[model samples]
Target: MSGLTNNTPRPIDIRLHQASRLLEIKFDNNMECQLSCEFLRVYSPSAEVKGHGPGQEVLQVGKEDVNITAIEPVGNYAVKLTFSDGHNTGLYSWDYLYDLGRDYEALWLEYLGRLSAAGIKRKES
Candidate 1:
C-alpha cells in the first residue's frame, strides 16, 4: 500500500486505554476505532512481523497478551509503537492505521485462519 496522500485522514484523537489494552483512535473523517493491543502487535508493519518482501511474513504468535508500552511520533506522518515485548520497529502511518481500523474484522479473521492452518494456538490472555 502507498504512503499517506494529501487526502489521507489523520487521527484527531488517540487514547490508549491501558486497563483495557485498547487504542481508541478517532480520525478527521469521523471514523473511530478501538484496536486491541494484541491485534496491533500481531499485524505490526515491521520487518520482523511483515518481513522484507512478499510471502515472507513471519506469523506472529504468543502475542495475545502483548500491549503497547509507548506511542512515539515519527515526524508528521507516522507513529512508532513500542510493544511490551520490546518490538518498536513498525512506523505506522496514518493511512495504514486507518486501514487497519476499517479492515479490522477481515484482517483479524485472516490472521486467525493463518494460525489455524499452521496449527499454532494462541495462548489465552
Candidate 2:
C-alpha cells in the first residue's frame, strides 16, 4: 500500500494508460498509485458500484481490459472517473482515496474473497 494519508490525498494528479487499462495517480505527498481498470471498476465509490454496504458490493468481472475514458472533479473534495464500459457515477472522496491507498492490500484481499464467494472470476477464462 502507498503512504497515503490525509495530506497524501490533498492534491491528486491522475494519468491514464490506455493500452494497459491502468490509471496512475500521484498525491500531494508524492504517493503514486497505479490502480488497474478492474480494480477501479470493482472499487468504484458510486452507490451503484459500492452497493448498499458491506456484503453487497457486487463483483465486477471482465473489466481487466477496461480503460479510463475521462476524469471529472466532483466539487473540491473528490473525483469522478468514467470508464470505457460506461460507468461514471462514483465520486471518490479524498478520505476514501486515502483510506483505499493506505489499506490497499487488505481491502483487495477482502474483495478477492468476496468475488470467490460470489463465484465471480476476475480475469477472463
Candidate 3:
C-alpha cells in the first residue's frame, strides 16, 4: 500500500530455479516465499502490463510457461526481472515483492476468476 520505510524488510537471499520457473526469496525477517514465473509475469508492475492507471491493467494471457531469464538489482530498493518473453521493465521493490509473496494465493485465485469471466484460459505448457 505504501513505499518502503526504514524498517521495511529486505531480502537476504534470492534463488532462481529455472527448471521449476520459481523464484525463492528469503527476507531478513525470516519470511520465505517461492513465487512462480507466471505469477510474477502476470502481476508485473510495468506500464506495459499494469498500464497507466487503475482499471487500465492489460489482461495477460498465455504466460503460464514464462520464465525468468535474469534478475538485476536496482540500487538497493528493488530488483528488475527479465522474463523469457523479453519483458524486463518492472522494477519490483522490496515492499512490492513482499506483498506479492504474502498475497499470492488470493491474488492468483482472483486472476483465475478474472480469466474465467473473460472466457480466457491459461495455456498449459
Best by lDDT: 3
Q: Where does model 1 exceed 4 Å of error?
A: none
- Write the residue-wise lDDT of candidate 1 on 38-120 in tens digits: 99999999999988899999999888888899999889988999999999999999999999999999999999999999999
Q: Which residue pairs clash in candidate 1?
A: none
Model 2 alpha-carbon drift over 4 Å, by segment: 1-8
Q: Clashes in each model (backbone N, CA, C under 3 Å)?
A: 0, 0, 0
Error of 2 at 67 (Å): 1.4
lDDT of 3 by residue, 23-113 (tens): 9999999999999999999999999989999999998988999999999999999999999999999999999999999899999999999
Question: Cα RMSD (Å) between model 2 and the true structure?
Answer: 3.5
TM-score, each model?
Answer: 0.96, 0.80, 0.97
In order, the Cα lDDT scores of the candidates are 0.93, 0.76, 0.94
For candidate 2, write residues 12-113 as lDDT tens digits.
577788787777777777777777777778788887866887867666767767788898887877888888899999877776776677677887898889
Query: Regarding lDDT, does 2 or 3 come out ahead?
Result: 3
- Residue 49 Cα positional deviation in candidate 1, in Å, after optimal superposition: 0.9
Better of 1 and 2 by lDDT: 1
